[model samples]
Target: MTDTTGAGGPQDHESDGPTGPVIRDKRRIDPETGQVRDVSAEQVQETAAEQVAGGDNAFGGGVGDALPGGEQDPSGAPQATSGTPVDGGRSADDLHPDTVVAADRLEDLRRLQAEYVNYKRRVDRDRVRDREAGTTTVVEALLPVLDDLHMAKEHGELTEGPLLAIADKLETTLGRFGVERLGAVGETFDPAVHEALMHLPEADLPEGATETTIVQVMQPGFKVGDRVVRAARVAVADPA
Candidate 1:
């Protein structure tokens, strides 16, 4: 039950059930007798203090998780030990001259891409407008021929013949290209669209009429879409 421990006096140790004999390294060499001595209380306390301060000596504890001073680090992450340079030792915002130049070139490339897109769109739009203008000009030039055809038809020269059929086909084909006739005798006169070639006296105006009215359409106008190619020439009757 009682045993000596190196330089320490006899101390009691309890039996750990029916197991084999336990061995303890409590002996040290005696200087005078040249024999082993029991360990002291002071040495036991020192060993315990060393184990608490340095963590588990027999089995590693908090080996890689802790810093040197046993104090909790602000961040448990390992500190950078090597002096590594980024972007050739330049700050992130103030990058190296070559890097800055490359970035500026990239920005210029982006700006050029945007400008090119805008220019292409403008060119496409102008091309469409030019095509429409060219079509409108050609159509306007043919108006005189159409007028002659109308006059001939009205005079009974193209009655139920190939000429009348050709004229009808021409008109229908032009309509498919957005060409439309403008002018009606009973409609109100608008100076923007109707050209008054003759005006009747106020006394000759129809009953209940107040504004200028188109009495006769001398020449029918032509238009394409919302654009007027030519104004309608008409005889107007003005009210008193």
Candidate 2:
């Protein structure tokens, strides 16, 4: 037998037989690169491997550094020495298309729900504002008729007549709409609801009066809820 090996490993051997000398090449690891060489399929069949071996590392300097399994030995248990890439280096969700779609649906649903809530709030507010505005407009239009009725009532013209019934019915309807009159005589004078047409003599003020007081209402002011439609024209007397 003749040994014909290199510095890296035993490459081949030659032997003398009855016919002649037989030389067989049995190189395993490449002498130059120190990497394992590809064994013939016949040799692998003879060895009877249950799994295919992984390729050499094209990635980096980790031990068996293969592609998929990151956990194997040179005996080809499974290959990669580095960890498997999770979802193509993105996230685990990228691997799950259903999960990605579900997340997107959830976000859309949240946004739509928020938009609907805001729309509902705006519509409700606008509806209320429109209703109040319509009522206020109607009240303002009827103010002159109401003043005429009040004057007629003061002159005893509305004493048990069709005009009195009409006035009562109109006032009742306005009251149901939250309309109320302001600035009665002897009430405290307020600039918000009362317009002073004349300042009466302070001597006209009764005892214990502290602030300006309405002495006479020239025109009754009307309001709806907290909104003042018109201030009352009034005569005021200063406090004594």
Write the residue-wise lDDT of candidate 1 on 58-165 in tens digits. Answer: 536674445433444357644332332335664355556897789999999999999999999999988877866776887788999889987896678988888888
Candidate 1 lDDT for residue 55: 68
TM for candidate 1 is 0.51
lDDT of each: 0.75, 0.77
Candidate 2 worst ten-residue window by lDDT: 49-58
lDDT score, candidate 2, position 36: 91
| Candidate 2: stretches off by over 4 Å | 1-95, 202-207
Which lDDT tens digits does candidate 2 get at residues 51-109? 32432243644554553555666686664333445545653434578877899999999
Which candidate number has the best lDDT? 2
Instruction: Score residue 94 of candidate 1 by CA lDDT.
Output: 58
How many clashes in each structure? 8, 1
Candidate 2 Cα deviation (angstroms), residue 39:
46
TM-score per candidate, in order? Answer: 0.51, 0.59
